[model samples]
Target: MSLVNAANRFLPSDTPAAFVADAQRVAVRGERVITLSMRHAGARQVALRYELVGAADAPVVFVAGGISAHRHLAANADFPEKGWVDDLVGEGRALDPANRRLLSFDFLGADGKLDAPIDTADQADAIAVLLDLLGIEQLHGFVGYSYGALVGLQFAIRHAARLHRLVAVSGAHRAHPYAAAWRALQRRAVALGQLQCAEDHGLALARQFAMLSYRTPEEFGERFDAAPEVVNGRVRVAAEDYLDAAGAQYVSRTPVDAYLRLSESIDLHRVVPSAVAVPTVVVAVEGDRLVPLADLVSLVEGLGPRGSLRVLRSPYGHDAFLKETDRIDAILATALRTTGETA
Candidate 1:
């Protein structure tokens, strides 16, 4: 059955935003009013966007990724063949959609609910509520990358009984000081843009910094040769052209307020790994500068007996999850085996 049919049968919502359906996608809006601080804002209404993929009776596997990532988890008409994990997840692939239904949602603190600064715990709570609303009492497993992985950590801690196995790739339980500093600079750039009545420019500037942090020196050295833009055989700092284009594209679609709220919330998020009862795998990229090796090692040690860590050597740095396919698939293979699909 299509997601629209499934939601109509289970959700029964009449609101337009509650169910935004079309020929290509079935998107749902999870609405709730959060009681915020009276000093600033007493309460705020939030509508989280989500999408479900695969069969009705299949075991559910929750998937989440970066901040900009939305609910398009696979190759649909709207997304063409560029779903975030399009290569790793499919029929006969790791966490095959044919065997396990996939659930994905937009990270809160984005455009939908910019009023409150939420922690990853809030994101986890939203996941629990979404699963309950969907009538999914339990999940076969949970997989998250980057920001999604942090949410997965919070989920494992907050809802230990909800899933059998967990997978977190290229995410840290706690924000690193160095990483926070870089993000702070990015936020600062955005704040400046907000202050100057040029949020679009701010957003683009922030993205430039982000692009650098997301990538590794190896990639730049191999691809761009650390040079400027070369147009018509004219070299004028091409990296600037790339950053400009990237930032411009990001700001064009993303809301400035939402970016500030979500990026700042990430810095405030913290979790006690030892408190996590669910069996978990913490995957780290060796070249990832955004998250320190010490931090990942600490997370594994904190996992106690049921916890283990896998460090994949790659030149992709923090973006390894998107680049190193075979390695990521191998890790997912273990998670699938460990989670023991019930469908």
Candidate 2:
């Protein structure tokens, strides 16, 4: 199914912006309208636009996730609907806006259509510029998942002193063969001669495949054991409902081009040891199909003693970062506390 196909099925009359509206509401309170604007990309010489949220003078955290322009979690409404950050920003979460400044933005890259060449390092540097705009001299931490994790690694390497700690979940400093292969297909899907073809069927199938890898067999089986009874000729199992809901949700909030840019950059990551001096923590999932455990292990080993690693036993694959929040919270709280004292 293509993004268009899925969108037609669930939201034939609504736009992706509608989902963004609802999610933005969940993230902010009264009078906080979703803000979008263009920022000068110092390194790339192009004025890259990004969507931004939160306020200043608070401890800051910068986020980048796979090829998304700051709304990947909300894009998939079924698994996460709102996003992992939503929990943190809520009244009682660690990132309560009352105390910390949370920054999430789209990286400079290929055009919104995902047809251009976007460098991961450049995107990281662009974010650094965004920090300068916000007058943040240093960050409490740089956090990421999947592609965002790759961006976080790049940030840690390029501006180590500027970041206190790096939290990478289901991400690696380097791209593995499996990730490369999967990314290639996604790219091919979006690169079809006709743009509509890529965005509709190609990217749709790509998302479906990516979703499969993001979850484990046990998780999928448990949730989808019973086939969806054909009601009105549509069989909607819990698992299928979950995926479609996620897909339909994102089709509106995220553009196909953004996904291409981020996914490609993630596929081409390489670490520069001399550039990475900050403390780092790499969070691995037991069943990440895109990035295997060995890849994360290598990242931890290469980061040395100050760099630590922990793995979560989740059958949800890479989606564990959202599905299994308790463990995520515990690990993050401990890591942040440890960094506050040590870094």
| Candidate 2, poorest ten consecutive residues by summed lDDT | 28-37
Once superposed on the true structure, which residue ranges of model 2 sit more than 4 Å away at CA?
1-56, 69-84, 110-114, 192-198, 227-246, 273-275, 338-343
Q: Which tens-of-lDDT digit does each residue in 255-321 have in candidate 1? A: 7767777787778878888988898898998878898667889999999987889999888888888
Give a tens-digit lDDT track for model 2, residues 1-343: 3332232333213123233334332332111112222222232344333333334445666665555434322332232334435544444455444445556654554335434556667767767765565456788877787878887888888877799998888888778887789778866865672465546556665676677777788887777887568779876666766777666655555567766766777766777543568888889998788789988888888888757889988888888877777777677666665334421
Global Cα RMSD, each model? 5.5, 8.1
Candidate 2: how many backbone clashes? Answer: 7
**All models: lDDT?**
0.74, 0.63
Error of 1 at 311 (Å): 1.1
The lDDT of model 2 is 0.63
Candidate 1 TM-score versus the reference: 0.84
Q: Could you give me the TM-score of model 2 versus the true structure?
A: 0.74
